[model samples]
Target chain A: MAFDIFHRHKLTISGTQAQALEMARLRLIWVGMLMMMGYLAIILRMGDLCLLHHKSTAMLMGSGAPAETERPLRASIVDRNGNILAVSLRMASVYADARMVHDPAKLAQELAALLPKQNEADLFKRLSSGKAFVWIQRFITPKQEYAINALGDPAIHFQEEQRRIYPDANLAAQVVGYTDVDSNGIAGIEKFFNKRLAAGGKPLRLTLDVRVQHIMRQDLAAAIKTFHALDGTGLVMDVNTGQIIAMVSLPDFDPNHIGEATNNEKFNRATLADYEMGSTFKTFSIAAGLNSGKVHLSSVFDASHPLHIDQFYIHDFDAKDRPLTIPEIYIYSSNIGTAKMAESLGPDYIRDFYQKLGFMQQAPIEVPERATPLYPSPWREVNTMTAAFGHGIAVSPLHLVRAASAIVNGGILLKPTLVMPDNPDVPPQGTRVISAATSEKMRRLLELVVASGTGAYAWVKGYDVGGKTGTADKNKNGRYENHANISSFLGVFPIWHPRYVVLALLDDPQGTKATHGFSTGGYTAAPVVGDVIARMGPMYGIKPRMYITRDSIEKSMKPYLKEYKEGQALASVSTDH
Target chain B: MRKSTLLWLILTVFCGIALFHTSQKVHDERARLAALNASIAHEKQSIRVLGAEWAYLNNPRRLEMLAKTYLHMAPLSAAQFIRIDDIPLRAAPAAAPAPQTEKIAVKKISPEIQPRKIVALERPVTMKTRKPAPPRIFKKRAAPDGGTATARNFRDVMKSLRLGVE
Candidate 1:
């Protein structure tokens, strides 16, 4: 009907009426176009919000409210088996805009009441300082944050920060280290791998097995308490891979409160403290002798009496007062015999041997705390003799462990590492330090030490345990103190197929009733190693032999044993106990 | 001309309805998507908190203390472990038929003695009178030793339960 009316009007309309109708039609068309454009814009905006620009918008939202969704700036540090040792948890830190405070003194007093550690006066000074922004406190607990948030202070604001938390507390404190409030690593592996960890991809997988670490720490702590030692250190490493399964230092500080720790607590004895690891170094000397082809298992060194070299007299700890075969020298830990062997090899060979064992330089580990070996200058004859018996030269326990690994693990001196290698099964192809035959003989000698000699306490019942003991007098003011001794034991288990090297040391250990008043390595450190092996062996999948015995070790060392003359009287001196 | 106008009107109406429905569907889906994204963010936050809590709970020191206090279980030692093949085989039972019931307490023989409580409570059910199917997912398994896997009775199940409790 409208079309019929329009048709009739069109037929009867004059030019003026037609022009008015045309203007009205054009206005309606323009209005319709404008409405369409508005709908199209709405559609485009919906598309953008849903698809094209959604991520950018979400990012904007996330940045504005980062406390809830922000990822950690630093990745977590986990053990080899994916157990978390250190993690960066998102935490709200309390900060203050001092310029925005209404009444600085009043706000400061109120905040001081909330934070018990802060005095009102100090807080007032901080708040009234001319600085526009100041940090009131950092890494506050959620409860404290809530308490402060409840204050409704306009001047105080919370900033989201990543707080490094060591969930295991002091378990691997010296290895994992601690980060500063600003999330900068200052010590240990955290400092060493700061760049990669801060790059933030996957969790940093360390080679440490926290279970084994706990075992070592427990035994070392117990030994420290029992012997009344000043401090103790323990380490366990895989012989083939050089992966540190466990590293422990007693008097350790909780990484969460790294700032509160004293210098003594922060001292990493395992890696940083260089000690004259007395008789344990004899293994290296004898191995060097064997490797240089100057000595064999039957090589004899007359250790009947002390040898006077200039003003210094090199005396055997357990003087046999008779000729001892090379293996006997190792098993008995005859210092004079080892020094004699070193004298024959000369300073050049001895120094070369030490260098080959990676003992002449700083420890090649992933931790920042490392000690450079106190290598004797000029390689003089006296220095050579003392270094042979492990007196004149000093190296960290980690250095000894790496060299020990070379002696028993097929003569390959692998670089000790804290991070688990990508391929752990393939052993590192390290520098050849000794012949395979020499390494085998070294294993036999070490086993013999645990079997019938000073390391008898380190003998685990089921495992093929083998190691040497070192009881060194503490050097004080350039003189060796008789009473103060660092007793240490370096042990390897399943010696036939060497796997783990465990080293335990007690600093200034005192003898106890349990130890029969003997503070030597054989008495103090060896038993701790035995306890660790007994507990950690089963966990490492080492089966205990119930029926099999190691009588063969005795048979192999028979050539190294000598018969005493009837006229020669032997005095029983138990120096190592 | 009239047909074309009608056709145009139909096309315009159809197009208008299609666009309106499409927009409505898009709006509904966008709302759903936003809700899902919000929930995912919430869950991620929860997961992060839970991970931290898990790490704290699994701390070796705390676990060791707990084990020392409550469990009293020392770390597994080498001596305590044995290989599976080390275990010896058991001896065969004597070739004799077992008695159906054994008396726990002996009494004087009397004709007037009442039946024991255990013996009086049990009754045998024939296969025909028993329920056809058991609630458990049991298959008609042929025993490896060439015996039929017969369906156990309710009495047997109850006896097993009692044994479990004991």
Candidate 2:
């Protein structure tokens, strides 16, 4: 029985081994099928890549459009009338990678043909320096860019850069100013408000009217050409608001090409050049005397001869050599009479008046280029005498305009500004420089200067123009040069209630035949003011009173100037020099 | 394997398929959003460029020159304007004519239908008798042509306007 059981067990073991072998054979077939499926997927993928669209993605990427970039925008600058003066344009600049450049000389020669400003030798030196990257040219024209792109140089690249553009060109160059290549403000209102311009949002709106600026510039250039002067400047200020309407300085440069402009072309003479603005100072001195309550329009000052003070003799440009009333002194522009008036008022009172007028310090204007007034260190009688007639003290034409504004615009001294105020209707409560009564009197006096005095040439038929004429000898090395003088006219129009003060200056005007060998303010600058008023008055909406006469203004000052009229008529008939 | 294990396995496969499908959909949406952002940036850049061009085109110097050449107009002057109060009411429009109506044929009407004479209406006697002043003289800014025509064609229209005004 044991032998039989052993044989059965052997048979069972063989049966189990044969069943396990069958299961292993079936599993091997399944594994073979899985391997075959994997191979099928790999072959299908290779076929799809080869037959359908090989390198489709690589081509799409290689010919892709330029990578998107965001460049910071700079703000625009506009005039008071919303005329665009300066703008920033997004421009493409070409640059090069020296490491990637294979043939520096050839590439540089090709680039030089496109960028005419850069020579081939310089470009080759830059490209061969082996630097990582270098700028080739900035703000290239579209045609130049297209030409450069056709070169197909792998190392050459283009980048969008911000470029400052002045659309008005040299219209208001000194005021609107110019910017550097890096889009930074460097002069004029641009320099004054540089950071605000860089942090770009809204445009910088100035208080300038392009039309008015054009008119002023046209008239000023004509006057300069006519008078044969070196240069000229003209400014129009809204006396009530202290807003500069138009400012023009001759020999101005185009802000777009600031690098090519000469230093003289870039100099802003209106606010930077200091001159001893001759008899225009008499207007201030008379106002000072009137405001001090010690002198009246009818008060008389002795001017029998040239008064010798220490080493100086104070005399008129054309001496009357007689005792004269204050009105006569102003109309005749008598230096001796004004000196006597200044002496009577004392140096303290005169200096105080000048300080109140902002003549002792820098002009309070919205420009970076400002000049401090040159005055005597210590107040003396001789300084007061010369300063009374606009000598011994130097101030810019802008300073004279501001001081004249205070004297004419109801005694309120306001800071002149390039930016318009938020509320122009609400009168700015400025520091008081004179009484309203005194201002009224000063208006009449200035009108006298225009009606029958030195500024007779500045008289517009129906605009009630009032002004003073100043012919200042050009000082050279502390000596007054003969035949070279600054002829300036300070004018206030519709003088009954003054609204605008215009200053026209001709620097070193030569004598002309038409002017009869006179290069004085009345001949050169006063006529310019008149022409400007005649044109701009109608444009500015100032009505023309067809029938207004000198009698209308004379009625107001009849109480004080009854005796001075006869003498003024004789003196003003041929008043040009 | 038990039937419950097979059911659990089937449920897990379904969840895996749903998550995979959701992830694919999210990838497609992200790509579309990226394309939209890029297009928006391009549009903004174009807008900035257009704005700059518009400003350049509208520069005052260029506009003034255009006005001078095409519009034939001068800048407004103070003399050309008057106080609003000076513009008197326009004569009450001169009593507009009555609207027309269909009428019987005059030639065919009978003898009893003879036309009656027109009567004029009388205004109120209390009205003032002030005569209107003549219009102020200003240089007419008549367009040379109808604005789209060339400069040489402007004179005929201007002459006709002058004749019409007269």
Candidate 3:
């Protein structure tokens, strides 16, 4: 066989050459083993990262994530038409770490220049206090915040805060109320629904109409100024729904500046203060009599002289001094006649009637500001006589308006609400306080007052306006003041089908030239109610009937007023006397 | 065996490049998503501020003051409102025949009456021609053909309503 170099395995070389080749193969095997071990270690580490350590690695990579936007701390308060009454806005509050601040005096001087409202001395004192942190100023404007930040002081920092803002300001102040610096609601509907507002969802909708509220305020303020009266209160309510459309109590305070408000300005007279509602209570008295079947429109009462009960004398402002029918009594606002009517109804029956009208307790409304009515506790006979003409018992104007609404709104006693119901199509459930027939009769009587009697100034020709005049001598320290009286008019328009009940009251109104030096409800407040009705009529699109004359009113009221013609003859005779 | 090793090395390089590219694209998309979310939050905040400002500007008291200063208008009075039934009906064309004798007398008095009536009729024709021009301009700006058809349909509906009223 020929031994060739190509077939090395078959040909054997001896000694050192063969041994060297074997050593080279052994070293190559060792290096290959080391490379395989390194690859295996890399595979094991990758498996560990993919299985158990992935979450930790991802978190480490995402450590610099962006922050989410924050929502308002409190929800907004809107009117019935979605007009914003109250809202919360984000603001920057400036604070300083006293320990980090190197030049407190220089920073204070700089901050005072930026914030004109903040005093330099006060800022320096707070900044130099050895405390670690101190608030320099709260709720700084955007302009001031930008200027202060330009100072570039690392010691000063900004804290995000929420501040409540009342955009409508003094327009709906009492109803929307104000909040404390810590964003806690302190009064009115804010305090009433604080938890719901703080939870932050949709805006809280109220039953107030901004347009109607403005109208009432403007008219009431004009009347107050003209008569030189103290603070006045006005309200408008839907009789059918018992929703307060507008409420104004002046001297109203701007909710934005709650710190500067006086105690009297904070007092909500519409729902909180109680007053003897004066002759406006006669509407309830007659309604009570009619509902009880004890009094008819044709029933007659003697107003020939002042009634003597205990030591009190109940005298009519314009005494007829003759027998007057129920319609005549209401139209003329005869205190003697109403007292006689209440005398027939008796004390227990009158008290029960008033209690049924929610007059014995606080007015049930959404606001926490309310007052319990003050009536005679013993329910004596004299109390019945006095309460009939709205003299002894005292109730808030809201209570009077709610009760008056029931009397004219088909006799259904509905709870008054400042918050609008969620479903408007569904009418609120109400308790029937009187028969619809009695309400109809009462409507006719109210119309008669505007057509021919003391509430004549409240009449709008086409609106068929009807109401009563009340001039109550406000009781002061248990004694009724002589010249200081609350003159008010409770008005309902289109009395044939009553829609809205508007009341305007002036506290201690003095007589003016425009009112013929007469500060009674008819002279002072009735025209305001009439003007408000006239302006509001076109807004509500209520059709005005040019054909609804006084003749037509008298004809419709003929059946109830059988003695009306006779009473008219007697009235003319008394005027002549 | 060397050829197979070379092919395996090329496949590993391609796989590594693809993995790196995919991860880089995912990282860029995540950053973009965060930016978009931040912008959306900013827009929502701006909308809230604008709504508050709108309510403040549209306050009835402020509007009334502005109207008093700038506008020549008065509050609507009760006398200004009238029932639709109270509107007097248009004089029938048949009543024109009753005026024919007076027209003949006027014609004898002055030939100028004929030209005056012609001018009055021409005024309405000019107005009618001018009315369609504005809608045509609007159509040119909106869509080529669809806007014209819709505008014509709107005009036809308006014309029919006017005829019904007449």
Per DockQ, the best of the predicted structures is: 1
Using all chains and alpha carbons, the TM-scores for the candidates as numbered come to: 0.78, 0.75, 0.80
lDDT tens string, model 2, A95-196?
Answer: 998899999999998899889899999999999989988999989987998999999999999988888878678889998888888988899988988888
By DockQ, the candidates rank as 1, 3, 2
**Candidate 3: where is the Cα deviation over 4 Å?**
A1-71, A558-577, B1-22, B95-166
Clashing residue pairs in candidate 3 are none
Tens digit per residue, CA lDDT, model 3, A1-577: 4745435678687799878867877898999999999999999988988787987765666623446355456899999999999888778999989999899899999999898888999999998996888998899988888998999999999998888888778898888888999788999999999999988779999999999998999999999999999989999999999999999999999988999999899889899989898889999998999999989988999899998878988887777779988987887788899889999986688889999999999888999999999998888998988888888899999998899999999999999999999899998889999999999988988887777677778878678888888888878999988888899999998797999999999999998776666788888888889999988987888887666766667666676454455334222211100
Name every residue pair that clashes in candidate 2.
B144-B154
Q: What tens digits encode model 3's per-residue C-alpha lDDT throughout B1-166?
A: 6999999999999999999999999789778867876787667657767777777777788766534433334565454455555544322234355687657645443455443443232212222111212211111222222232222344653443333231
Interface RMSD of each: 4.1, 6.0, 3.2
Q: Output the better candidate (1/3) by DockQ.
A: 1
lDDT of each candidate versus the true structure: 0.80, 0.80, 0.81
lDDT for position A551 in model 1? 56
Tens-digit lDDT track for model 2 on B63-89? 654455444456543344444444433
- Score candidate 3 by lDDT: 0.81
